[model samples]
Target: MFLIPAIVLSQRPFLIPHPLLATAAPANASILLSGVLLSLVVIYLASKCGAEFSKRLDFPPVLGELVAGVVVGVSALHLVIFPESGMEASDSVVMTVLQWLNGLTPDALTNVFQSQSEVVSVLAELGVIILLFEIGLESDLRQLKEVGSQAVIVACVGVAVPFTAGTAGLMMLFNVPTIPAIFAGAALTATSIGITSKVLSELGRLKSKEGQIIVGAAIIDDVLGIIVLAVVASLAKTGEIDVTNVIYLIISATAFLIGSILLGSIFNKTFVTAVDKLKTRGNIVIPAFIFAFFMAFLGNAIHLEAILGAFAAGLVLDETDARNELDALVKPIADLLVPIFFVTVGARADLSVLNPALPENRAGLLIAVFLIAIAIVGKVVTGWAVFGQPGINRLAIGVGMIPRGEVGLVFAGIGSASGVLDKPLEAAIIIMVILTTFLAPPFLRVAFGQPEEPPANGEPSLEPAAVVNEA
Candidate 1:
């Protein structure tokens, strides 16, 4: 499995007169595959260990995965370092291992390094698509409908307040540049439905009036957050906001989501018929993914984020008779792919920017402090947005929306990839995500009067948080 470099080196003289060209050819492909496999090994170990430790501590497993990634990433071990961070193949522990094992030439090592990074990045992207799809499945449209206007008010306020307040404060108070400020502000908009829902379930309040409002608003918040992310991510790429592009994204995202859900009945019928006719395995799930990938492709093709399409696909399928079965089938796939997404997000973060010793790093530390304040206070105030609930626990509704969770990480990752966020700013966004995610569960428990320990009955776990790499 690892002899490709040896085979190539031994045959190089006969195959080509130019050593450099020969080294850059198919040799890197073989090594790239090896590097990716080793990277996955490290990623899985970190994810599982981190998740297991976090679970024991009563924290979200996703937090452990992020911290674990930081430990193995450029922030510490340098075991899974990337090329974009100005690191060479020699900087990566994985690459060093491969070199020692295969006796790679310097030229071949560089090629393998770049190729390996690209492939891992692609896998991380796929992991997010799967994560969004699973989120869609969990966002029950029926529940969303039943919850009504109060939830809508809460969700709108949750998105608008933080976005407006965070962006303006960064620009006005901190003198930060516009695009980066917008990206950071956009990161604050997402409320992790998965994490909040899990907490509500654990507290036995998933059926409470307040619980229903929180869940419903969070569902709406996810949709709005994706739209906001799509717009800001596009703007980040261009480094300037184009009004036309923003309007187009907003309209297209809204239209795509509404269109797909509207047509869901017709699609669901065809989907069921196809699944029933197939005697082979993956009958239902296969068709579901084809639709998902197709929607994701359309989203990208239309200049929107691919996740929007994947999300819309999930919503459409959520209405089907096969919803529960599809949810069960999709979980294992999500488990395999989603950790790669979370770990990579964690790995890319450079925590060194948060250090207070350096004069330059203080700005980042302050930004992080500012963002955390905005993240909590902005969402917490959304509780007051709930009108006509007479005696509703408005504080609980707001607290539930506070955790940015996996969804916030998605924003930071995209912003970093777009190169609009400087290291300091990017690190600040990550810190805010981590703090808000960690704080939400306990704050929620207190807000709800610290409900009893979850019952021992084997009732199907309402903790969908575990499914999405959040809780």
Candidate 2:
């Protein structure tokens, strides 16, 4: 009877337990819940404050959010670090606070920390998915169709130039091995559609001709990046490329995008009819999320990014009569979630690798500079790759492609995990990603010309109307 009571009380830690029960009480669940809630509070506060400050400084708000994440993250405060980044529970200030407040043992703290980081990571993933979906809805299908060829050319050039040049340069100049060189080259090929699109949307240029071409190219770039990653990752693990997997990714990616667009009309009509029948409160928005999440699920299930499916879903829904209402509904949701994506991307970037004072980092810093130069020049030239758009903002298009963002980090992470990249090479790739990701936003604004003066209220008025009305 006493044993049963002690077991019950241990699980419910809030209750005042007998002396034996108190020592056995495990608070991992409650600690996880508390840590997650606190993490969210930090995320939201940092996001809004960073965005507001950036906006005031005449920079893209996303850049501010990224910077804010860097401040609170591992490099500085240690408030929001991740386990995958090789950080421990003790390294996290938030975890420390929770442990102190809840009197958690070290073992319990580790479990709570891991669980909390995972929840935040999942939230960040969803944030990007929602952001892409919003971008899709704002995009005009006809415009995308018009610029499809140019976008393809840009994407192809962007991938080919960087891969060839970076791989050959690394092997010849740095005396690097073939596999690691190939991996670094592959890292250069990624263009963060999320970052570029968010910046484009903020600049109120999402519907412009240049914007269409950039968005379209970025979409194709993502698909191509996935294929490159698959090939290189296979090479890393087994020392041979898997042709069968490569072909499957190519075929499936192409089929998925084309098929999604082709069947969009049918999906739209069915969606509208369903919304008309539903009498519930979330009749419109809830069903929309269901389709979006399902499409996202399908994308991940097939080895592609979930954002692609969400984006494809948005394109389908853009044809619906409910587009306007749906856009309004989604904006608040995006505002809430999208910052998490941007902030986490910033947080994961460990800037200590760039410190040249350390003997080990000096070599990596030199390689990073070379990679950065190549990264910029390779992507910039893609602008001139456009054949038909005689008067397009070619420079803006090129600049838009510069940010490697989270996609580049994925390459670095895989390289590190596979044991193909040494410290200097891995640090070089990460530094390259960090520089490219930070530089693009400010440069992109300049490429488009000086930003317009703000209204009396001081906000840039980044509504959908602004997106549609931009020249």
Candidate 3:
């Protein structure tokens, strides 16, 4: 039996001798495969580590993932090493082996990794859209009606203050032209509602009065963020911020929003009614995915982020009982896809260009610090925007909004791509991203009075805060 097994193994295709033993081609192919496999392994292991870290630290898992990337990337540890001269020499044979794997069809390896990166990016974009949509779905529009004025005031102030501080800081510190600074500051105006919501939920104050105000303000913040982004993008392309164009963008955005809501409401009724009539078997997920992609595509056609459409779709679903079922279905996919978004953001962050020795680099770092300070302080002040209410801690609500997470990084990416920020500035923006995300959870836990120990007898000890029902 042993002899037969040996013979079978020897005869396998994988065990066959290389026909081109003398060529460099085979060695290169081997190298490429190693890199791809190594990247995958790293991602999986990092995700596991990230989950544990988040639980232990009481922070968002994204912070853990960023740490994981720092370990693998050149920014910190040189775990994923690629040697020059096309010759691999390292203490451990693993680096050599990875180099050999990467050598195999270098072009093919490059193409494969690029495609994989793009796939992850598309999913990440989808995840953001879904996240925003979930927020909209969960939103109480009636609450907005009650505190609309307050929300608008807080959001406007929040956007303006941070933006001005960020722009001025960038311009003075980096000595960059005015246009880029304006764009950079504009990027900082948007609040990442996901991070804010996560912190609020952890604080056991998701239904609090201040929480409601923050949520309302965030919706306005997002709208303003898009407008600023559009204006900046136009300026980047045209080399001047046109007042006429800005006016047009504002009008267009308003129409797009109103149109999306109206159209979404009508489509929601029609589609849900049809689905009810069809009495579909199994899960509604596949159809739902199709519908989501279609709406995302439509949003793109309208010159808006597909996420806007996804958010609209979610709002429509929120009006129906099917929202719960859809959430259940989508949560699994979100779990698998969302981490890729965070990790990819980290992967794309190339910090090597930021040499602290250089004056420009040092200046950029200072600007980053200043802007981050403003970003945090500005939102914290907005907590006071919850007016006509007493006995509520507005500071907690503002603190909850401190983290920028994916959205802020997305804006930084836009600036980098549009030539509004150099590599070092981008690195600085990422630092701010990491800081805000890492800090929020612990602060939230403290603010909300989370007990240090589990309640005895497994009884729920904490009581929900009094609901500040303005509506």
Tens digits of lDDT, candidate 3, 24-122? 245443543454456556655766686567657765455566566556544554443222111223422335454354453444444333333333344
* Reference-based lDDT, each prediction: 0.74, 0.83, 0.58
Candidate 1 error regions (>4 Å): 1-24, 148-151, 175-187, 190-241, 388-393, 403-430, 437-471
Model 2: residue 100 alpha-carbon error in angstroms: 0.7
Q: What would the TM-scores of all predictions be?
A: 0.79, 0.91, 0.74
C-alpha lDDT of residue 422 in model 2:
95
Query: What would the per-residue lDDT of candidate 1 be over residues 231-271, giving only the tens digit for each residue?
Result: 78557666555677557756875677678778988998998
**Model 1 whole-model lDDT (C-alpha atoms):** 0.74
Residue 54 lDDT (model 3): 68
Q: What RMSD, rounded to one decimal, does every model reach?
A: 8.2, 8.8, 11.7
Tell me the number of clashing residue pairs for each predicted model. Answer: 0, 0, 13
Better of 1 and 2 by lDDT: 2
